[model samples]
Target chain A: MASPPRLRAENLRSALAGPFDVSVAAGRCLAVTGASGSGKSLFLRMIADLDPNTGEVWLDGRARSAFTAPAWRRAVAYAAAEPGWWTETVADHFPDLPAARAMAARLGLKEALLDGPVLRLSTGEKQRLALARTLLRASPVLLLDEPTGPLDEDSVGRAEALMRERLAGGAAIVMVTHDPAQAARIGDEHLVMRAGKLEPP
Target chain B: MNPIVLTPRDLAVAAILLLVDAALSVALRLGLTRALGIAAVRMVLQLLFIGYVLQRVFAIASPWLTLGVLLLMTAVAAREVAARPERKLRRYGNEAVGLIAVGFATAIASILALTTALRPAPWYDARYAIPLAGIVLGNVLNAASLALDHLLGGVVREKPAIEAQLCLGATIGQAMAPLRRAAVRRGMLPVINQMSAAGLVTLPGIMTGQILAGLDPIQAVKYQILLMFLLSGGSGLSAVAIVYLAGHRLTDARHRLRLDRLA
Candidate 1:
């Protein structure tokens, strides 16, 4: 008998999005592309249970409802495109400073940047740092929204390599992006979101 | 010493002081003349009505009557607290939160003062309990209302930061910790200022009233000091209670930021 998919969303519906059903196996990446208001972000939020939605999401055949919201989020981590910073300094957000520094270096960011105030970082720098922060969790399933939207070619390549590394370690990824070429390069399967529904591109 | 009694003629002479305020409003085109006149009339009527009610209650000296009056005062204060906030909880949630915080703090403070400090004959004596409860409720209502207003406004303003914490696997309480602390601090600020300024920049109202009623200056000062401590303790308790209750109401069992709960 075949093993159950690593992550599965069945009949997921939110106020602004969904009625979506999809499956992603271990060690695979599913790239989603959509127009600006196509509810791509909302879809990811519903899957992570960050918003109020009606859905059944399963990780390794375990129901999302079975685990507490925080536990489920910890297992299925969502990295927002424009993540918010609560503290004044960047170092306060990360639990392991050394690990975060390593991840920052891997994402083409300066290790010294971590010690400075968060307000000083540029938009692309903040995006990369946020990705590093999320990656440190090493969740079994990763939900990424426009992770490379603000990065340059070199930075994007570094980020894609890092994501591929996670995938190789048996982590499933669902990424929302606008760049079709990048999706083709990084995505095992490409899907387009239109009017809150996913479709084959 | 016996205090000088103010007759109806004395009050009519006092009414002339408000005419100066009305004249200033008219001269400045401040559009407050009518409001000032209505407010003056309302204050006189309300104070006179309360005086009459208190006289009857004191004459009867019944516990149930005192309790009834206290509850009525608390309900009215709770309504006022709930009404002050711009972003209110939906369907009387604010009122309920206000009542719990205000009622609890007022009761605790009043009972402590009446039993320990004053030692009124019955302890639930209307003369002591009603006035003390009224004073404590007045301070607590302000603090609780300020805390609720700050919290509701902060939740809306800091949605992104709060949601980010929730996404990072924080429980509702953990996520809202900073905002809650800030709201409580904001609520307690006024009382802190008042306490610091008492006997220095300004004499508190209770102390001034007691002195004017021909009580010994030292006795009035002691009462004022006792009141300052009680007011601070009561305000802090109410502020903390209301902020936490409102925080729970804003989130849900699933730890989601339920902004839809606000009206």
Candidate 2:
């Protein structure tokens, strides 16, 4: 039998989202598309255990409860739609400066941008940098909430390419996106969320 | 050199000072006259009541009675601490946390001072213990309340940032470290300022009273220095304890930022 999927959610339910059952294997991506308030973000948040939710999530066949919350979150990382930066400078947020610089370069961000204060960055720039911050973790499962929401077409393409590289390295991805074309391009399986339930498009 | 005793007639003379403040409120339409009158009456009544109680307690000098008064004072201070914050924990969580911190810090500081520094005969002597505990409780109450206010407000304002840190695989302690530090510092600020300004900008109340009671200036300064040390130490302990306790309440075993816990 094939090995268990890298990330599996079985009957995950939260107040605002999910009774969601989904699976994404290693080297594949599950792209979720939904309207503005269809609970796409909340679904991913439940999978990451960022919000209070019921039911089970398994990583590499082990239950979410088996690992500590921090460890589970480390392996199953969630990048928020508008991620927060607590520090004044961008460099303070990243543990590995050179790796962040490389990731920034790949995401079409300038090296100088990494050294400046985060407040000065545009929304698009902040979004990409946040993605870079999450990507550095090399988590086995990546949950991206509208990762390319504010990026221009060219930048979006670059961000997608970077995610594809993570997939190539056997990291499973569950992404929430608004762009059907982008989802079609990068997603191994596409699901539409409506009223907290996922359905095939 | 005995202190001059002020009779009721002399006290009435001192009460005349409020006329200037009342006149200003009336003329400026600050609308504080009612509040001012009520507050002045309350202060006089409360102080007189406390003086009577302390006089009786000193005569009895019973340890149980002394402890009872201290606990009563702490409960009142804890309630004050709980009510000062704009945002509060649901139920009386803030009050419970404040009581624990203030009670613990006050006990430790007063016990240490009485045993090692003052060495009052029969250490729990009402005269020494009541006044010292009162002073420590007053400072600890301020610190605990201020720290709680800062933590509750900070948690709400910085929710996103805190949640972001948790998302990045941070434990609750790690996520809350900066906020805890900021809140404790905010709480300790008043005592810090008072310590730095003591004898330079202003004579602290206790020392001023000691001097007025004809204690030697140098001896009064020594007592003031000791009291300042106790106040600062108690404030720091209470601030740290209250912030950590409140922060713990704001999060959970799963390290999630439980914003629902706050009201």
Candidate 3:
């Protein structure tokens, strides 16, 4: 029998979003595209268990309730659109400096930017840094919500490349984005969220 | 020197102080004159009523009565803590957190004082237990309220940041660590300020009251120092407890923030 999908949502319904089901296989990306306020982000939050919802989510055949929240979150990371950084210096966010540097470079960030204060970074820089921070965890799956919302075209391309690399390495991803081309470029499967429900692209 | 007893006639003369305040309010057109007058009347009535109640409480000296009074005070303090915050836990949540945090601090602090420091003939003597508990409760109430306010407001303001941290695999405690620290610090700030400026800025109310009541300056100073230390301990414990409890209330078992807990 084929291995269970890497990430599976079974009738996961958020307070504001739907009772929807979807699955993404390992080494694949499922891109969710929707208009603003169409519940794409809400769907991701539900899968990540960041919002109160009905139904069950299974990761690699393990029920979400089986693992502790921290462990589940570590395994299936959620990268929010507007990421939060608690420290003053950028490097403080990542545990390993060398890995952080490598990830930063992969996301088009300069090495010196690590030592600088996070408050002074531009919006695009912050966005890319947030993604780098999430990717640094090497979680088995990624739930990305508009991960490249603020990046320019070149940065977007670099981000897409990094995501493609993650998918190539056998990590499953669920990404919410407004860019159809982004969906077309990296997504192995496509779902559009509308009126709080998921539909075929 | 003996402290002179003030007759009603003598008290009438002291009442002139309110007129001075009223006059100042009128001169500045601050419109506080009527409020001041009403407040003065209210203070007089409340103090007299409380004085009568304390006399009866001391005479009875019942442990059950003492516990009842302490619980009542705790409930009132908890309500104040809940009401002062612009953002707060839901009514029942606020009350529960406040009662637990403030009640715990006050009980521990007062018990320590009674058993170790005061050591009255009866450890449960209302004179020492009630007053000590009241003073400690008053200070802890302030600390607890400040902590709850800071924590509730911080959670709302930092929702995006907090959720982000949660998204990054932080446990609930890890996600809320910064705001929790901030809330505790804010709660303890008043006590810290009082300690730092004790001699320089203003003589504290307790020391001044003792001095005015004919205690020796040195004796009053010793008592003030002890009281300050107790206040510090009480405030710190209360602040930390309130923040931690409030933090727990704001999140779920899944480590996700439940903003709906807040009003």
Candidate 4:
């Protein structure tokens, strides 16, 4: 029999989104798609424990309540659709400049992008850099919202490739996307959110 | 040197000064004429009441009375500090914390000054303790309020950045470090400016009052210097303490951003 889910959510309900359940096994991707304003991002946020909700989220069979918010966040990383940057230089966000450069390169970012200030980056660049930052966290479970929304075809491919590498490395991923073809290609299990309920695609 | 005492006639002459200010306000349509009139009445009433109260309290020289006055001032200061934040603590939360912080800061500075520089018989002399505590409490209260206001505003404005840091595995302190630093700098700005401008752009109140009361100019300046140093230390301590205390309240034991605590 396959092992239990690496990330699990039971009865997760926000005021806007209802009591939903989800489970993703190791080395698998669960893609959640929904219409605009359909609580897709809210669902992702609930899983990441960023928003207030009623639910039990289990990581590696351990309840989320067992971990501090910081530790839990470290285990279950979140990449927001509209990411926030605080520092001036892009390199300031990363722990290792060379490693960040490598991740940037993998994400199709130019080497010089890391040296420039974050304000100078394009929306696409900022999104990709945010992805790089999230991935650098090395969490076991990843929650991504519109990871490719701002990207070009080449960068989307690069991002998908990176997600594939992580999935192959036994990390569980719950991604929110609008593209059906991308879902079919990358998702191990696909769920559509309608009227705040998760259903089979 | 005999200080010039202001009699009733002298005070009436001083009241004419308000007419000049009122005239200017009326000419400029500053809308401050009524405010100035009300303030003049209020200042006279408040000062007179305090003057009588101080005379009675000093005549008795009771430690209990001295302590009561200090505590009352601190409580009032705490309330003033608690009132300015947009995101207030659950009723009396910031006020209680403010009380303790402002009280402790005022006590430390007052005790140090009273014991060493200007020690009086019986230590808790109303003349020394009450006035010193009032000055310290007033300055410290402003600093604490400014710190909390900046902190609340910063947290709201930088919610995305703060949440981003938390999502990246940063602890509450780690996520809030930049905001806290900025808040502290902003909170201390007025005090810092006062320090820089003292005797240059403006004559500080304590110095001007002392000089007018016929103290030697050099002696008044020395006392002013001492007060400046005391206020800097007291305000800095109160500002930092309030920030740290309030910052902790903004998060939970799990180090989550309790943005809901904010308005």
Per-candidate TM-score against the hidden true structure: 0.95, 0.96, 0.96, 0.92
For candidate 2 chain B, which ten residues in a row score worst on lDDT?
B158-167
Local accuracy of candidate 2 as per-residue lDDT tens digits, B83-195: 99998898889899989999999999999999999998999999999999999999999999999999999988888788788888999889989989999999999999999
Ranking of models by DockQ:
3, 2, 1, 4
lDDT of 4 by residue, A70-175 (tens): 8899899998999987788888889878888999999988989998998899999999999999988788999999999989999999999999999999999999
How do the candidates rank by lDDT, highest first? 2, 1, 3, 4
> Which stretches of model 2 miss by more than 4 angstroms?
none
TM-score of 2: 0.96
Q: What is the lDDT, from 0 to 100, of the residue B170 in candidate 2?
A: 93
Candidates 1 onward: DockQ, in order:
0.72, 0.75, 0.75, 0.66
User: Number of clashes in model 3?
Assistant: 0
lDDT of 4 by residue, B98-155 (tens): 8877888788888988898888887778998899889888888888889988988788
Q: Once superposed on the true structure, which residue ranges of model 4 sit more than 4 Å away at CA?
A: A13-18, A35-38, A52-55, A194-196, B90-92
What is candidate 2's CAPRI-style docking category based on DockQ? medium
Going through the candidates in the order shown, the clash numbers are: 0, 0, 0, 0
Q: What value does the lDDT take at residue B242 in candidate 3?
A: 90
Give the top-scoring candidate (DockQ): 3
TM-score of chain A of each: 0.99, 0.98, 0.97, 0.97
Give interface RMSD, per candidate.
0.9, 0.8, 1.1, 1.3
Compared with the true structure, what per-residue lDDT tens digits does model 3 show for residues A75-127? Answer: 99998888887778888888899988988888888988999999889989999
> Chain B alone: TM-score in each candidate?
0.96, 0.95, 0.96, 0.94
User: In candidate 4, how many Å is residue A14 off?
Assistant: 5.2
Q: Give the TM-score of candidate 4.
A: 0.92
